[model samples]
Target: MAKITASVYTSHVPAIGAAIDLGKTQEPYWQPLFAGYDFSKEWEKAQKPDVVFLVFNDHATAFSLDMIPTFAIGTAAEYQPADEGWGPRPVPAVHGHPALAAHIAQSVIQDDFDLTIVNKMDVDHGLTVPLSLMFGQPPQSDYRWPCKVIPFAVNVVQYPVPSGNRCFQLGKAIRKAIESFDEDLNVQIWGTGGMSHQLQGPRAGLINKEWDNRFLDRLIAEPAELAKVPHIEYVREAGSEGIELVMWLIARGAMADVAGGPAPKVVYRFFHVPASNTAVGHLILENQPA
Candidate 1:
């Protein structure tokens, strides 16, 4: 059986990508936004996991508001770049780990979590921003990106989204799916989104840095406890429709052991207030060696 090595969390704010491209990372405001990643960049380079199972939500890019699946897995060979109104963020297309993804699909089925498999689709800033932050645009030629990916997109945009506990359960199930894989490959699961701030109407530009930092501190050391926070509270206090942090529970749940213990610590954490309509909270957690 393959061993699961690391799990990382990232906030995908498209503006951050623009900041990096425009060399604004050194600016006082933008500097702190990317500052938390200093250690994460090094950790990823060292671990060099074979596959990254990214847990992110689609921003009405692939699955329109018409129909949305609570949880969707990409089993395709490749994913295209999505055009988020302005234009496509010129970057190499994302490559998928089909073998591992197929294994996850089967395992998840056996575990009784209904999933929608996407063979062909495009991903927006939700997935690419993190890719650019961590891996940059894929390198030239046939080989690109430091590792392959299995994108597990959660739908958090529409109402009636999955609950925090439900997302956490999915994460636990995902770990089982990965561990049961016959192949001997190193894997990392990433949960993206949230720290507070709303994108719509009057609630826009809301910043709750204090709450964001507190959430980060707890997420690393006591995720199981964090997972218990109710969804209604997330939306109410975090901001209307800002309850998307629940998706992070899925990433946190994947780190929990069957015997039940504290998950891992945040080896690297970055927080940038006011990334467009949201606060960018990026974190990376890896299981401590036994």
Candidate 2:
């Protein structure tokens, strides 16, 4: 049977991707930010999985005001990198695991969580940046991402988005779906976006280091309690975009501990500020083997 080996959390800042693509990672401004992911890159190579269940929000790229799915899952055979105003980044296209993805969709929907099944769509930086940070740039000669990815997008851009509690419950349903799959596969769920930096209006460059750190601590030690936090608090304290943190709860909810198993092992944790216009945070938590 398939198993969810771990959950990864991080902020997907576009500028970080630009720095890597432009060969500016070693520069003074970006060096520290990239350094934080050095361990994650190596750790990813060691704990390589057959597929990555990536959770992120599309920033007005694929889904705009025309159509919005509160929760969308990509079951396509492949996904292209999107052109988010500044053109597409020089990155490998993402391959998808269709069989497993279809299974997850069926299982999740039967469990009562509505999901839009996308067969064709372009993936934005929210999805690609996380891949680059954790896997680094692929060689020019061979430019395929390390593993097949299943993109799970949430609608945080629009109002009436899924609450933290709803996302958490859906994750539990995802765990159940993965475990039920008959294939012998390894999977990792990643929650990307957020660490408290606003990018709009007069508060264009707001950063709350204190609130971000406390949130991280609670996420590691008491995620269930953290899930109870309301949307207004995230907006008021962390900023509007800070609501992205709710996606992290989905990944956290799929862990073993949430299902009456042993607590996950925190393999790595990192936090940094001013990555473009956001505070970057990254974490790697491995489920304790049963």
Candidate 3:
């Protein structure tokens, strides 16, 4: 059976990549921000999982408010970069693990969780930024990503999003799906978004560094506690519609390893202020006991 080697959490701030490309990550405010991810870069290289199943919310790029899937999984052979309002960020097309993704789809279905499968889709910065942060560009000499990615899009942008408990349950289903895979491959799942901050209307620049850090701390040691938080409360407390942190629960749920344990080992935790109307928080968890 395939094992989930690691679970990581990172903020998908498009400006960060733009900062790196424009030589702004080294700027006084951004230098330390990027520095925080140095260890994550090292860890990813060391683990080098065969496939990364990423969970992120599209920024009205791939799925607009018109039609949205609660949970969408990419079962395609490849995914191209999406064209956001400004333009597409120059990046290599994302490669997918169709066999595994298909297996996950079947597992979720059997487990009674309806999922939307994308055979052909374009990934926006929400997926690519984390990739760029965790793994640098394909290579200086080549223009491709170092690893293959399976995109799992969540609909947190639109209202009536999935509940925290629902996201958590889905994670359990994902773990079962992955464990049933009859292959020998190292797989990693990532849940991206939030710490706290808002990005719409008058609340555009909200920042709660304290709450963000506390959320990270509790997420590692006391997930069930965090899981109890309702979506409306998250929006009210975190910010207007800032409840997207629920998606992180899905990632956390998958890492829970329910058959075994009490808590997962948190290898790394990072929190940064002001990553464009959001507090950039990053975490890495191992399913095995510490």
- The candidate that achieves the highest lDDT relative to the unseen native structure: 2
What's the residue-level lDDT of 94 in candidate 2? 97
- The TM-score-based order of candidates, best leading, equals 2, 3, 1
lDDT of 2 by residue, 105-168 (tens): 9999999999999999999999999999999999987879989999999999889889999999
Q: Per-residue CA lDDT of candidate 1, range 191-286, in tens?
A: 887768676777666777787788888777666787778777676567764576887888778884532745565577677767667787887776
State which candidate, 2 or 3, has the greater lDDT.
2
Model 1 score (lDDT): 0.79
lDDT by residue for model 3 (1-290), tens: 88787789988877886886676887888988899999999988899888898999888877888899999999999998888876777778898999999999999988999999889888988899999889876665877777778899999887788888889889889988998899987888899877677778777777777777788887787776788888777776677646768888888888745545656778998888877667899999987743
Q: Which portions of model 2 miss their true places by more than 4 Å?
A: none
TM-score of every model?
Answer: 0.92, 0.98, 0.95
lDDT of each: 0.79, 0.93, 0.84
The clash numbers for all candidates, in the given order, read 0, 0, 1
Weakest lDDT window of 10 consecutive positions for candidate 2: 195-204
Model 2 scores a C-alpha lDDT of 0.93
Model 2, residue 159: C-alpha shift (Å): 0.4
